[model samples]
Target: YVTPVKHEGVELNILPPGEDLEQIVEELWNTGRPGPEFRELLEKSGAYNFYDFIIIDSAPFFDVRYTVLSIYAATRYVVVLRPSIVDSRRTARMLRRLMKYAKDFGLSTPDYMARFLGVINLAKSGTIEADALLNLKFTGVKPSKGFNPFKHPSDERRKNLEKSIEGLRKVINFSNYVLPLNADISRLEFKEIIKGGKSDNDLKNTTENLLKDIWLHATCQK
Candidate 1:
């Protein structure tokens, strides 16, 4: 009875109040087994078509059972590994666990483990900025050109954010799949991007770049 919740939407309780699991199971069995009905319900609820790209964000320790089930059902699985010893070790352990689960379930073995895109050295640290991370081959989302937002209120931030966008675009081209979102989608807060009275185009470009990177990184696996 795992609930499928949509991002940026209402959260529905998976297990209803005062529901007895044993009674529900018995009732379902009384109806001559409910596998087909359950499958139809899953499809009819729009959970099947909610998004072209579904990201299952698991906890650091990876104890969630439903997430594991979803990963087995997914066509692609992306594992993000930081360029560090500790993160690499944790990722290896997680992959081992996933393989063990697949074997236990008698699922077919995955092909091409490296096909799952590995984004190395993500995020910035200390005085290092986004551009610095990009220079180190870390895929990021930033403007393309140089524009002093403080000096030019009407100027766009597209120039400044293009490099990261280009890097992400390359990855998307490699993956051969466009995102389900519109080109003008932005996930940033207005306060952060609109400082010094910047144009909306900046936000639009940033959003597009962000979405592209998210999809590319998330679905680049086998």
Candidate 2:
């Protein structure tokens, strides 16, 4: 699900998965003009509510339409990358295509150019210095740390989850959002996947850190 946060006086709209962009845009324009009605829809849909931060979580790679739509709609773009060669290549290619599409659609310019945030790295390990450097060349966001000690259903699962989170966290950090990998997220067993299950301290610390990061980032933007 895509989560949006609004803080300060800046307005942010996060479009997550399962949302129809065309429909949303249509609804926003239904009121004749893109003004209060669009803003009202955003609030009514729980996408915004006077806050100054918005985060939209898009679906996986297989679901490309939503991802493209989300990126197009976003005022800032945050691309998540991994240390692995394959993942980095894929992300780079995706960015290239996205930029090309934006240009083709007349959405690329100085005003919109700054909106293309940067790249983020997730669960990086092994010899990825070269890969990371290349990513930076593409104007991606590189964080100073990685979220280690990920928890999963099993040892193997944990490892896999760690890999994914490493990539995801890097991307998130690049976006200037310091959302840590919570051990408690693994404890949330939902018959299929677990969200988190870390000790209270770990969970609390993670949440606090994330909030602090958000506040600092927002303040800096202002």
Candidate of highest lDDT: 2
Model 2 alpha-carbon drift over 4 Å, by segment:
1-51, 101-111, 124-222
- lDDT of model number 1: 0.42
Question: What TM-score does each of the candidates earn?
Answer: 0.40, 0.41
lDDT of each: 0.42, 0.44
Ten residues in a row with the worst lDDT in model 2?
Answer: 134-143
**Per-residue error (Å), model 2, residue 113:** 4.0
State, as a TM-score between 0 and 1, how close model 2 is to the true structure. 0.41
Per-residue CA lDDT of candidate 2, range 1-109, in tens? Answer: 5455675574455544355755865665565644345444566876445545655666537555556555544455555554454665566456545555556346544
Runs off by more than 4 Å, candidate 1: 1-46, 49-55, 60-66, 81-84, 101-115, 119-122, 125-136, 139-187, 190-210, 216-222
lDDT of 1 by residue, 1-222 (tens): 666566547554353324574464356446662434434555677865864644445453544343354454454555554433455556556655555444433555444243344443343332123333333333333422442324332323323333333443333222222121222224544344434244355444443454455565556522
